[model samples]
Target chain A: MVSAGAGQAVDEGADSDPVIRVRGLENRFGSDIVHHRLDLDVRRGEILGVVGGSGTGKSVLMRSILGLLRPTGGRIEVFGQHLRDADDVREIMSHRAGVLFQDGALFSSLTVLENVELPLKTHRQDISTQLRRDLARSKIQLSGLPDSSSAKMPSDLSGGMRKRVALARALILEPELLFLDEPTAGLDPIGAAEFDGLLHALHRALGFTVFLITHDLDTLYAICDRVAVIAERKILAAATLRDIEDLDHEWIREYFHGPRARAVRDQTSPPG
Target chain B: MSDPAQMTEGRKDDNEADLVWERGTEGLLLATGDWVLDNVELLSDRVDALAGLASGLDASGISRLDASGALLLERLFHRTGQGPTAAGLRQQWRTLFEAVDFACDDTHEPAPASEAPWRQILERMGRSTVEVVHSTHELLGFLGITVHRLLRTVVQPRRLRLTSTVYHMERTGLDAVPLLILLSSLVGAVVAFLGATVLRNFGAELFVIDLVTFAFVREFGALLTAILLAGRTASAFCAQIGMMKLREEIDAIRTLGLDEIEVLVLPRLIALLITLPLLAFVATISGLFGGLIVSVVSLDINLVMFLDRVEQTVTLKHYLVGMIKAPMFAAVIALIGCLEGLRVSGTAQSLGEHTTLAVVRSLTMVIVLNALAAVYFMELGW
Candidate 1:
């Protein structure tokens, strides 16, 4: 029941107020403007998949909302409070959110368990060391890593395993919101699918809001409750896969109707 | 109140995370408050007190719970010798608890035991000795490869990369000229000052010219230039090639049927060989000029007399003695840098370590070779 040209506007029509809100967002480096007056909302407890062509400022947008990059001009609200570019507000936001950067970004020196335990130690110093280790171990187990991998350094692990370690570290604090930047960009197809499945399971079980940036159509189809298409310096459309697939837009039409997209669609959808 | 975010914030109050129970009859253990990451210290403290309680956990009184909290609850269950039941928990809390419980294997792997200190020291010393021997062998092998490649290029002139050689020559030679001149001139002036001071006591101040010219020509010029290159160019070569190897660029050249030695090492080596001797010559001239200025200004030695003195005493044999060591020093420095770079193994740390080793080894070899050359020249009575 995919209606043609159904998702034309960039507005979100969810009943509940969103967990993250961006309004009049503008990002500029020198004379080159990456984003201008970009407005979007990330609803509570939904995997909002963000898709864009390379250098379309998908990462810049994520950074701005997460307070890593201060937008040139914009209002960003997380958990119903305006972000003021202050350290305290950023600290509070950091506690509530976990980010999985592309390439994992695990500290090369620290072991997998130490890397995961670090956040708990930093945020909650009053928690005993034993409890911290146990929590880190649980997070590692939830990340689908064998307990043996816990003592190994990040440099010794494969790229996939490193990503899992990063995920475990991200989930250790049990954040209310999660941000993933190109989480499946470099994995093999099977590995990417398995990661997607793991993410889906965790999302369901934890019930936390997810803001995922990805170019993988399979990942978008597999886990995203809604897809937000960023193009032309703003969010072109933000809607479910079926709704966005029928949008009368150039990038969206090309992206969702491409040969690869067709294959992903066939694999994800049932027979007509 | 309907907002989960607001509810979570509200549950952050310290009093919300409390555990209450009757010691007898009911076995009803009530867990209250926010059981999240922020309240973990308090929750864990409360949980530790009831560590081995074999009571039916009625977590219905719990206001909030997250993964960290659920993991803490699972720890309590493990201690109590019972699996957590969903009987008295909310549906969402039950799911979270199950997710954590399914993954939480609380049995820790004991730390590996340490060896005796003496045994450890012995093992380390043996390992280092083996490493030194292995490194020397590898260095000899790399030298053989480089020599073979150089001979091949000598036979087939077209195989030499002229552009790369010139580029490196400009970098390692031309760019280094000003610093070399500055340091050599300063050293020459200092030597003249000291010599003049000592000779004036004997009323033989004219001998300062001989001292300055002889020191610069036979020893200081070549030694100083080589030492400077050891610091500057050798480290540069090591870091450049180490980064290339780290990024697999060296491997890419090999896959393309190109010899990395020919493509990467030969140019740097040839450039240093050509430029080092030239730099030594420049350093010699600058050093003499420094001596000339000091002698004229301080020692009252006329320019003509100073030149005449240098011409009379310092023979062509001394210049040859100094110039001969430049190419030798250049080869050692270039080879050590390239060999250390080629040995880098897949980490930024390794690159840093190899770069440092390149500089230290090249500096040591330069000084050692210079000392041997000095002894030989003295024995031959040059």
Candidate 2:
């Protein structure tokens, strides 16, 4: 870990605070400011999906929270502790924050067993190899992947399978804070829906906060406790899908009750 | 925590759901930007973390880089170095982090490199071409390593292993046999035929047996095989690893707290070191086979006579000299291949270029080492 640097923020939220706070967050490169004093929070145990158009700074914000990107100003306190920028925070947040990368980020060299076992290996060093395998297998099965999927590489697995494998890795750690960068961004309707189902099950099973970033409308409606419509470098509003439907924000009205949103929502709508 | 006056700012003008949403989004931006600005101290921290993490292919017994960059960086960090290795560089990196304006929770990709000129870019390559390649610095790294390791092991005792010795032997040594044999055999057969023709007028064509043995075993055969393996295996290792680097696999490993040398380069270095000598030995045998073909035919020297002559002309010293060349050649080739591979950055095109450079550098290094071995052997009058 590198030495502590400047720009430490003043605000510190409490443990079990439920809300993640952001203050005076500004991201810029040269003269361009992508985020200007943006602020938002995902309450504990809520599935918060962030929706945005291309280049709307949705993923950037997600990366920032995950500490993947250093903020250009501001503070990110997770479960009420300051996470200084360093290379080793992944180990610190080991089982606390699970991330499902866009490409699934599963190692090409590793089989599914090995990939899911990665986080488990980092945290629980005492488990037998067979126990680790069993844990990974269970995570894979919990991810809704078929039995045949456990041995596959990221390349060997289908796109949906890759996403599931990523989800499996995320779940393997049983993190309290989950970040998914476009979990169903590239999947087909059926594939995407199934993936969304897996997310619902994961949230229910883990009782964790899901910081979900996506462009998928149906997924937002299906799983997100509050969908934050990211547009113009700001969160349009973070609210439940039902609240989003009634919102007066121009994009919100058009986005939620919009024809496109309605068409996607109708298909995946659960039985009345 | 909800203030009515702030609510009137229209920013606070929202329900808990909206307030919660807005705060989460806006706060994220603030926190991330703040973290980076606070960390700008890194720019001044002239200590490149990766300096000592590499191994196998790049050790050239040289060290370069003036502390001039340190002077410039110190100004940024507001520090004066007590000495070159003082903690000034790291302190500057921290203090500089204090100055940047960071987005709370944003890490947008900066605009394309072409759009940003110097004085605007923080990219490491933002300096000059030489600054980016660090060629002189890297070439000189052998000294840095020797000194650094010497100090470290003494301060805290450590064990060193040439364990990768076997791996390089396999990848570079074993895998190189078929090609080295094929190429050297052809060279020997062609040389034998041509030598026999030239000697015919003297009515001493059978002496071509001596020519073949001396030529293949003592000199060119082993060198040629080394060059070929350097081109094929060494270059391939560089390009492959370089591409993986560009893809952020290197960063991923580092983030996971793994050493790049032990995890990636050592295995390759081991493969090359172990394999090259084996390949060289094979090349000499194959070249002799090719020479025997001509001795049996064009030179009118029977197989038995040719064998006798080769046995006579080539001594244990000749075999030992070539074998000696193989491991050194292996080390050089592996080192150069790995060096060029790690040097690759940017697009897929850079990977190709680095691969080519790896091959070229390895071949050049192999030739240089071969020459050194030759001179050393000649000095011994063997």
Model 2 chain A weakest lDDT span, ten residues long: A1-10
Residue-wise C-alpha lDDT for candidate 1, range B1-382, written one tens digit per residue:
2321122234445656765554563555567778788778767776666654546666767778888888877766666555555436666677778878887674345434458999999999999999989988998999999999999999999999999999999999999999999999989999999998898899999999999999999999999999999999999999999999999999999999999999999999999999999999999989999999999998788999999999998888999999999999999999999999998988888999999999999999999999999999999999
Q: Which 10 consecutive positions of candidate 1 chain B have the poorest summed lDDT?
A: B1-10
Q: Candidate 1, residues A1-272: lDDT per residue as tens digits?
A: 11123344534465457888888899999999999888888889999999999999999999898888888998988988888976846676668899999999998879898999998888878888887887888889898888778889998998889899999999988888999999998899999999999899899888899999999999999999988888888887778888788778888879999999999999989789
- Pairs clashing in candidate 1? B16-B33
For model 2, residues B116-156, the per-residue Cα lDDT tens digits are 55544555455656664676478457335433543553475
Backbone N/Cα/C clashes per model: 1, 73
**Model 1 — TM-score against the truth?**
0.90
Interface RMSD of each: 1.5, 21.3
- Residue B230 of model 2 has an lDDT of 73
Where model 1 places Cα greater than 4 Å from the true spot, the runs are A1-12, B1-15, B26-28, B53-56, B106-128, B194-207, B345-350, B379-382
